[model samples]
Target chain A: MPDRVLRLQRIARATAVRAPARRPVMIAIAGDSAAGKTTLSGGLATLLGPGRVTTICVDDYHRYDREERRKLPFTALHPDCNYIGIMEQHLQLLATGEPILKPVYDHRTGQLARPELVCPGDFVIAEGLLPLHTKLARACFDIAVYLDPPEEIRRRWKIDRGVGKRGYDKHQVEAELQRREQESADFIRPQREYADVVVRFAPISEREDPPGTPLSAKLLLRPTIRHPDLSKVLAGDRRWTIHLKLDREENGRPVDALHIHGYAPREDSQEVEKAIWAQLGLEPGDPIHTLGHLANGERSEPLAITQLILLYHMLDESR
Target chain B: MPDRVLRLQRIARATAVRAPARRPVMIAIAGDSAAGKTTLSGGLATLLGPGRVTTICVDDYHRYDREERRKLPFTALHPDCNYIGIMEQHLQLLATGEPILKPVYDHRTGQLARPELVCPGDFVIAEGLLPLHTKLARACFDIAVYLDPPEEIRRRWKIDRGVGKRGYDKHQVEAELQRREQESADFIRPQREYADVVVRFAPISEREDPPGTPLSAKLLLRPTIRHPDLSKVLAGDRRWTIHLKLDREENGRPVDALHIHGYAPREDSQEVEKAIWAQLGLEPGDPIHTLGHLANGERSEPLAITQLILLYHMLDESR
Candidate 1:
């Protein structure tokens, strides 16, 4: 109970420490592992140009590394398995446009690596499994996002990354995922409600898309904060590529659901991107050309559009 | 310059957060490696009673594990080799009677281990190589102590601990100490100037003491903070076990140097302890009997007296 109260007080202090004249616009992209958080964060950082954005992985605050975690009863998804307090403290520091010496966890080698000094830039993007896990952490962000990929799709992505890159076998990956299911459901998924934007990147279920087709993004923009007038710029999709519809929330409140189709043409998305960039009070000369490059050297127009929408919030908040 | 200024501001915040009804009194015991830091800190914790004190070794904030450090040009004593920024921040947090998820650097295995939650109790003793290395960090403590051992004794102590317990050969320990000497002089020794009390434990020079004789202590009580009225307490030292002398600082400023002899019997030292404990407004029972227990199962009367003086300062600040 004391910890809870202490955290509450710290949250108040975190919100109150906005005195820095050029504080970073803090953004959180929180999701379960393999939920496209890194991809989205990287795209945004690239879009903002060199040194304009500092990206942090809250997973670095893991209480245990991969090897030691195997001995634990719970997976990393459990809040107990991570240093949530340190993550919250670092978030509070960075949100105030201050610096932090953040811990490092090496996912590939399953070891805790050396820490690094992180100085906030014009924008700070914090992405990890639990950036929005606690209210204290979420309170430190100017905008919070949650990735909500379909379970099946996220499983496939995890297996591919775990086996192809992280030196884990398919069975181990599957078993770990199974062990984490309850935790993810209990802890990770619940954070979506706290996010201002919930992004689900998956193939359109109704479409008979081929294996190589790009994934679409469904973004639920909550009214907890003001969002971009995306409808104004996205009125002409030419092919019904981008559309916004008024959706009802769980509490019967009207929310905005902006869908960007997988097959959005580069030219059409660029038109919309240019419009959003111009809204930032800057010249829209290819401002966000590098918004959606996937690790496998593929392009996803939906990812680009989603990033631009987030970028719009980032710039809008700074104004 | 910005980091220094930021640290300064946070230091102010740290000191200003004394509104808690039971804020922990912070004390720092800083010195080079194998400087009896853990031993001193453990004794202080024991004397303070169970659960009433929290001991923190700031060395846990090491930026790199021992293996990685071997490849670096500087030793762990170098400020850059540790997370000085995070250490300062965590000190600020803990000094404010707040909880912190502190990182762990395992000296035994030379690996970065899992962090632990530290909740400040009635007393917080932070002992490490660099707790007083920065002015900002030093400002968080109510009482600051620097352990200054003669080079020969410190070397022997390090080699003994390193080779016997930490799995290092004598040659390796000596080589590492040689590599660290420059950094120790440049970074570690300079912190002594920032301390309110400097403690030097060594054999009484020119005395015909045997090898088994416990080391005596010479405490330079700088006027940066008020010192207990030891002259009053030592009006009758029986056999001159404890004495207070007017000392001169480098700039001819008057300082107090209290010297306690190793040959002082336990009974005489207890008298001094009783006097100091009475000053704390507590009943002088066996309040400080557990102090000065060395690692080799031996006890030192001088150590007991040193800890009692420090406790006087800590309790006085709380009052």
Candidate 2:
């Protein structure tokens, strides 16, 4: 065997014995600000139940305050704006079930708050812009997800969140979005390639749906890991409520595309949730009502389903 | 009130004392030949249970047998080729819960079989190419549906069914499709505008899915009747699995477009189903597995959902 393969095998064996077998399963949810990382992670934490999951926001690793960030040439999306090395170390620690004094960033005042102690529980959800930016950081996760909402939707969400929660007006949010565009394109989107699953939320095109229609979701499931068999749900029947298609090849490798229709009937959404729950050997009545939505309490069926898929990976790894 | 309103009210009061204060609800499923009418109606019949629903194939109203049809200048889709007057009378009789001696056409041998006595059950499904071709016929239905599968997919299905079941080869089926094109366009397509629901099934575009990937469906719910309130399932949340959008207005009237994603997770489909069921005040455990698919045993989620929607109307009318 090649040296690299032998080394990887040894590491895998070690990891099987030490990490997943004895430690909490760690998931990395990487996305730009207001890209729904908190919502995704919080839902997973809820699904796993209270005290069973711990969440860490890597944006806390920002070395400069928001005001200081304004004076810097680079935006918060850049590696230099964050303590990337320390974030990598903490992620590795959390993956191995260790605790750390995690820093906190208060978006309300754009200041760094006092550090708080965090313990790894049965699961750890690390979410923020830079969680998967480094190879070492990527290696620390049992499962990794990237939230890739459309720029326009993300901007709208950011503006809404900024005004409502962080005391920023629409103009400031718009300016910030423009300022971060270059860094985001350079640093954020590339992380999606490293994720096991990439979720994009957007509206269906070419129609004037009434305002408040749910956003549709497109999930790109990479071949990095095995996903549950949805053949029974997705195959043989025409007129399915959820569509799974083989996406155009990426770098000559095929990927599966799962499109969860927005405004899908509750029964249809429940069917999908049950299929996924069955894969996890979970009971049917556990109430998955909390999985898909933002922190603002806006619900999304695709986000819920996407989070469930990631949870499946974590459970598989732990087992 | 207008004189017509007063007369109609009096007639309604008299009819209530005499007629369908207890009559079978009638549903019309109209489409071109090979448009999946049998599959759709059979599923609904199954859903409503065995002895409760009666199905009538209006193709039985053909004025001529297959050999005789071949001698005529018009195709089966043409009104001149069918017993339109008799069909209208039979539909009216069925709507009023009366029995009729309905004709039978043996699709296998292309011959007219002996007429059979059909009694109106608690529910009657009239499925064929021209059930909604006339205003009187349309009025006889409590609910009307038109299957509008894309031409290419319909063609493939036709060729497959022709070869496998009807004992026709590929070339013959192709020739028949060609022969029927003009009449189908002129007569069959027009019925869609008259339907309360129009269902179209096709593969998701821009991707090559595995052969068994379920076909997605688009349902145009015309505002001819009040549909179940899907507001909870479709509105508020931005990420739904079943999407209901405002269709481009038809004849300056707004309609709702319900798109059921094929290959949707079973959970998502169930959510949709449950929402509709809730609207109908139905218990969640009622089995709905039999609602979608063809007589050939092919299944479609959208078809099932579509049938469920129609069933809702029937149940509503019956109540």
Candidate 3:
């Protein structure tokens, strides 16, 4: 045999032998930029304990920093500029209980910061620009989530966040949103179709207490290879029931607000979210935020339950 | 005009105006695996002086570490597997005199170690895998270099180097090389075509006891850009010439082996190197073992002069 062939076989064998035995699980949380993705991820990480969970920002994959993105042909939303394949490959390696060198994009300086070596543990949460856009990266994740708050809600969230640090006033923030909307409109919205769960945090209705919904979080769970079943949570038993109302405003008309009930959410489904509210230690009378609308001080019992219940199912699935 | 559009235009103007006014010259050094590219870049950096010259390793863009690459479909050499576009964009930004947050790759742990903030300097030398591959990155550089040592020499060097840390003996090293060659054959070899200058180091042939080429070097200068004219260096009238036969191997092969002469290395480059060498100036000809490379050995005329001459050109062009 040629010496080279012999060497190849040996390296393959050595690599195989050295490879870690435990497989890492990948979880992707897709949301609009600054749509509480980090905050939510951080909360979950803290709850799960840092050692069991690893968090990765796809934002780190930005080709250029904030300042340079303006000069590029496409916005940061474009998949061509970020190393999507590399991110996918790294996720796979991490899922397999191996370590990877991750490229970091520094938000402060808006440059490729440095390579960060990430070792996967129990869960690898990959969040960033278009994690689900690429087929390979999407394949690596065991569970996927897309946060889909209403446009107004998301706009307010962005404005509030940007106003303090990004040096944008209310008007400037509003303008920046319009500018970014076109670039991300096609790309960001479509990811919802691929999400295992689409989370929307909005208000209950225009007529709720204080004449505005505080915070109602809604989720559209889609079945994927990793998560084939959602019946556990979708099965509407009071155990999983979130009491909330959803209203759609179209053509200057306020449509009827549908109230969600707690009994057997759907037939022929598993009770996945039993005791979810209790897990969050919430009660029927407890005041909480609604989803899809961001009116101030709107209170809803079911929407809050829905938010916590979905989270319950997700955490359980990942575990 | 829409209020948002107006604001975006204003932000764009402010950013464009705020961006660095005097962009620095970027130099890219490309080479095959273990082809002494790092050594050449380091030598130049040392000669140019650190404050004025910054060296960056694009190896940080690797999606996975050595171990993780085992399971990856494409190795780090593959464009898809690396964040090449991001790397290119960062290079472009640096060339424009902007500071970037670059990912850090740790060789010892084989992971993404950290994020480093790199500010552009007068001479930025970027070296690593596929430095010259992409057009965007290529367009950003003022100079490009490809190190083309004979494959046989590169293989030998890889073997010698891998044996110590990788726990590979001669046989294992040979096997690893064979395995790597297959993957690298497709991705690495072709990049050489893009180089503006091709450099190779070997012993002068048929010179019995002709000043032993000590750490000898030779460069084939092909100017790709209009700015840096090397007519002065090629003429070799006023520039320094090195006459070391260090390239001769044990079996009568040419492998640059000695350190000889340096004619009029730039004033700053000389001062920086002198400062570094002063610490190692235990004795005139004492060998300094650093990261497995030998330095400050027997004086050879040609090798030193060649390295210095290249440094002079690089520094002069940088200014």
Candidate 4:
């Protein structure tokens, strides 16, 4: 080959090598209109610390607010309607531990809210529609989760929350729910298959118990990509103790259910919570139970434990 | 219902709902594995006619093919793994009568191959992993689709296609499955959210075991707000005709389906036996099937028709 051709080949090779470094991870969170994924992710950020967590709401990427999804071709589920590729590309950047300026969509007013600067923290928690739903977004997360609430509970939550906070009446909330259902069917619900955990807040047994004070939480963990057995966690190591609880119980009356996780089967549970102790840097006799009293009667032990577990997972993933 | 808030809202609304002048319709086909989305879309496009058909593959948006996906976090299923948002923006421009330089990915090489300038044809079809996935993308299509092929068939199709075209043996294909499954579960399959149609190609009855063809294509048509009723196309409007057929039959069943549009489905299908006829303004007898026949015997009919539907939907939405 001519010298010029050789030079061009070298340049081409260099360019090819450089391209991968330039790309980053783009995580997206796609879910039903009011799935409360944000609430869960919020706790994650708190645990990881804001500096270590970069949160991107896929809703912000919406060209139109919740109102506009109704008139679109495929609802928000279709890639054509959303800047999916851009989000994907951004995610690639994040996965590579790079910084990005992500577009923000304001939920309060359905519009491009702001452009937030996102630097790769120890952990990047992207919560929105389709975050874990795409191949690109999935690659970025060390762990992925889905929040699936009972429809009735979700609706009731939406109604109460809407009236209380979002400034919408029951009728208006219902209308919004109908509109959102179209998009949810087309774009949100399918993301469940991609989650490592499917989290449901409603109580089991389908009882119509008035929404429990605080919230009752249930998480079905489907751990993928397991590494060499960390018997330490199963053995209840102190460090692992913060995030996990190990125990054996009767599951379906006959089957034995064993856990190496933070929550427990008993309502009384353990008086000493590892996750809480780990975060607060407290020992068994820490005086911070005063903070516990701050909870008044609004929170349940499971809820508190669940929060601690979420926090531990976030910090652990970051580390 | 505060009068001031209501009055402000009315004032903020656009004065006229202009029915946005009817433009070409654009349809996006998005799905996972062997979802029969492409096949169903082909039939619709064939009925529509070539003068209004244009096909653009969102698969082309992949930054890397199967091989390169291994080194990446999310593979093509991740939003960051694609140039999706840009693609959506381009589609939007095309729907409004513009052109774009689209990036191409070489499946055989597993690399970014080239970029080609694509003009907006009469009708546009954009299909791929994340098409109709994001808000920006969803805006570009008037119709959106998701193909949900059964896992067994999807795996088989992926295996055969990988072995046949992409140069992967069975073992390597299995390994690829292990690698790609994470991203696929996380991102690629979740795109079902944004689809107007969740299409599956398989037998509904396991016991009957239809001998003719195990794969009976099924589509869950989740029509958009303005999704056109196919009843219009069923009526004999010969202005444009799209043709769809079983392109490849396996075990007495159609393994591959094809679509030709903008003429008589029967006549047009015959004319383009080798090429997938897309783009606009074709003579009645033009060979539209060449696009599909260029590579393997694999019919590009599904791809072509998807483009046509997308084109129609895009134009229609633009109006």
Candidate 5:
């Protein structure tokens, strides 16, 4: 045989030997209600290609339905409101590339749906509150992220999502927010510290720019894992449109902060997007259109970029 | 002459024709008291080389002494408390590379000590509260940055600086912060919207890491100017440690966010620093040791990186 053919056969034999033992990469996206967790994960799913990615929402692990939850004094954010043991076991299964019958919670109807059979794909993205709240749950994932939109912005998003799609009226949504505020503070927000990355979507303060302007994002990139280097991409201009700085202090420790301008020229953003796509070892023109999109179908460049970064983590872990 | 030397001579001749008309690059660093404005400016001065840079403090424009100000209902943050007209004129002069006899404010004694000769250099960094508060002052700067440390963190920093350096007790410092709160809100903070960059130093929330842990920084880089491309630098790892994202919304517009991890390995930060230095066209291994050190002599990696980004702006403008 030719040397090249022999080399290829040797590599194929080695891959075949290792293929059965390789586990799928697991990612956890932990956040409060209406924190855009679904939007984020859906983008990643589209980017990774259907059938290659499996997504699970841990909200399905709730032991109580809406009516049942309403009867209790505790909010859905409480750990006791969830089937913590089952969720933990399923996560472990997914981490190990095992199949599981996963429960489903229909947010629109606030009811428990039929369990669905899920086989671990090349990638698994588990998003919802409390995913990173437990040690075992956290250990099951190769990467953990927390979506942390500002309260005011999040409240606005929740009100819109609740009233528009979830059958909640303005007054009802406000009351729910007020009721859940304590639980969110007590339980949900605390998960941020456990995350390797915290993504926040907030309005630019102090400016009177008109509405419909894309929202800005502040990413707190903790050093819990190895991150990509962006220095070369930013080497050309010294302007602040996109840049990196060390985080001041968080939980008494120093972290890194990454800022991206919503108004950055399309070309600049494209360069960044292409770079990130390349990091995934994917082609430059791969479909990223779904990455920064909003529920209304309007594209949010920031959201897309945020999802791309998370996708990088998942792909990196698989490598 | 040799062809290379002849080409250089021709270029030098072309440059001389444009030299007299070129204006010095002006950078404004505006922030409330103890916002680390001086430290930030000082770092830039060292990086750009002292002889090529001039540092100005607009706080010198205070029209009243400390005791005299005590009798008034207004705080120094109020425009009425300052020589707004003179500050405007001086800014214009400095922007045009002219000189002024600038007034001085002695924070230690709470007095106007002297009026000194001030000459603008190739690079001028004006740091103080309210530099971007007025349209004319804003117009004078090639780059404008507003330091926006969190109120809680700022209060703590003010108390420390006031007690340790300015000879004020805890109660006295607290009283000053309380007294100035309204004016700071009304005047100083509003200037942030006009800045090209808004820098905030904050501790990691939620967990209690340790006191000595490095702080994280969030820099809101507005799209007022063209910025550098950093996609290549971040293209490799896909890790969250150092990365950039498009901001969700700022003033109803999109912005870019850059995050750097303080806990990142030295090699990682060095890559960023080297990239920025290359953008500035500076030689590698140039002195940056003095960049991130604080007033107390302890170094903060975040502060240093922040200073470096600002330096890139200055050097870019000068080029």
Candidate 6:
């Protein structure tokens, strides 16, 4: 037997779970349903390369199916409606770079399906409704992000994504959103306080952009974790590209808010990407084109820049 | 948080999976289809009581469903038909008293069903067709048992079990049995070499018993593990109930052959039970009547004694 497996045997006999020497870096991308979490996590995973990244949707731990949740008084976002203990346990396992047989909550059927065996790789992107639900689950991540799109944008995205496709209508989704609002407020949004980065993608309210323009991105980078030095990206002659300003949060703590315009010229976004990519000390070529693709085949420069920064964090941690 | 969970947290940060202080006792009851693995394991689990035993069927790790297997050349019994690595991984996890979301193979619909989360209790009964098929899987158990019902009896049990209920005609079932026999010989029966106990329930060939007579049991207890001393049960005037004698295995090695007659009177089997129960030193109340029950409600004295001896092994392990 290989020495690693033999070590595992010794650990099992010792009545203790000992892991291998290599541990994967953990990243959490948390947000409400239809919050573009899939887009972000999938993009990051793609950049990390196949078999080198394990993408875990923590929602697979839901305690009930969609129909079952309809019967309960609370929404699925509530901690009581999911197997948080199992989530915490699995997170702990993955954090230690071990394998897990993760449950598959099939969204197409609105039910839980057979699980699949998942072995963690060099990086794990655990994205879903409640990956950041508990303190224990939160502690597993080296980088935590919360998607905080304004309520109106999120509502529009939900309606646009589900209407006529999920057997849901505009009014029904609106009502469902209204019903979930309390649990969302009580459980989901509060996770933003713990995130190292908070991202909001929406149209600047004062501007009336063209109908087809992508939403811009505003990332509030907290000092909780060492973030990439965006000084060069925000440096000279980049006013048309991005703006970095100090902003006071509700708790009166100042945070660095890095804003990137969705309508920035392709050259400007690529230039910004090059700056961050350079700091990562990669060999020549940039993996820029692989980062910001939406599932529907549309592209967003703001989304690309957001992923680049996250990619930087993951690479920095690995280094 | 408890001190144990705190220890787990530390292990995770250290990039290794160090387990808690306690581990489960693993028992492998391996046999062919309809060869009484479930009956034996269920009886022991019932004796052990609720929330203290996790029953795992290694068949859950099958790589293909019944429909999918129809197009393949090999029987489901072949090692190539299942996820052996995942099965071994889960067994290691359970052996260390951890939790796993085990896959589910639904026999009724001949399809794979959703998986479930399984937490190991103090005792884990991992009974299935191929649990002891590999050196790795065999190494996970503290006590290994192989059910070796005579070929005639196993065939009869399969036919009786499948004939009207499973949409199986007598001819079709016989053909299936003939088909599985090669794989059974190649992969299944060979596992007996690795078991601590080899149990075979069959009527003695020389005796012409009446129709519907319960089968007697012959247990080949190997010295791979310390078995409880059955001197008192075989001592004195209990010859009519059970016979213990020195036997030579096919390998020409000495083994203890413990035979209990199914036709023995209830009081005689009860005497054998008391002897083993006294050795276990459990609660004062005997839990005797609870053993030896078939799913259809028939009772077998020989079966009860077999369970009693296994129960002793498990309780002894915990001690």
Interface RMSD of each: 11.4, 39.4, 17.2, 21.2, 34.1, 7.5
Error of 6 at B273 (Å): 2.8
Residue runs of model 5 more than 4 Å from their true location after superposition: A1-21, A206-208, B1-319
Model 4, position A103: C-alpha lDDT score: 59
> Candidate 2: misplaced stretches above 4 Å?
A1-21, A206-210, A235-239, B1-319
| Candidate 6, A1-41: lDDT as tens digits | 13324655764445333333357888999999888899888
Which of 4 and 5 is the better model by TM-score?
Answer: 5
For every candidate, how close is chain A to the native chain A in TM-score?
A: 0.89, 0.88, 0.72, 0.69, 0.90, 0.92
Query: What's the TM-score of each model vs. the native?
Result: 0.84, 0.46, 0.47, 0.41, 0.47, 0.89
Candidate 1 Cα misplacement greater than 4 A, ranges: A1-22, A66-73, A109-114, A159-178, A203-213, A236-239, A264-267, A274-289, B1-22, B65-73, B109-111, B162-179, B205-212, B237-239, B274-287
Q: What RMSD does each model have against the real structure?
A: 5.7, 31.6, 16.1, 23.7, 31.0, 4.4
Q: Clash number for every model?
A: 0, 49, 64, 120, 69, 6
Predicted model with the maximum lDDT: 6
Model 2 TM-score relative to the real fold: 0.46
The residue-by-residue lDDT of candidate 4 on A1-319, one tens digit each, is: 1332244335434544764333222223345656777666655455445665667776555545556766665555555666664565566556655555455666666554334446666666678777765554565555566778888878987797788777888999898677668667656787777765556665535334353333445655444523222233234333322233233222322211122222333333333344344444435553223222111233344444544545445444433
True contacts kept of each: 0.07, 0.00, 0.16, 0.00, 0.00, 0.29
Which model, 1 or 3, shows the larger TM-score? Answer: 1
Tell me model 2's lDDT, rounded to 2 decimals: 0.77
Error of 3 at A319 (Å): 6.8
Evaluated on the second chain alone, the candidates' TM-scores are 0.90, 0.88, 0.72, 0.62, 0.89, 0.93
Candidate 6, residue A38: how far the Cα is off, in Å: 1.4
Chain B, candidate 1: TM?
0.90
Best by TM-score: 6
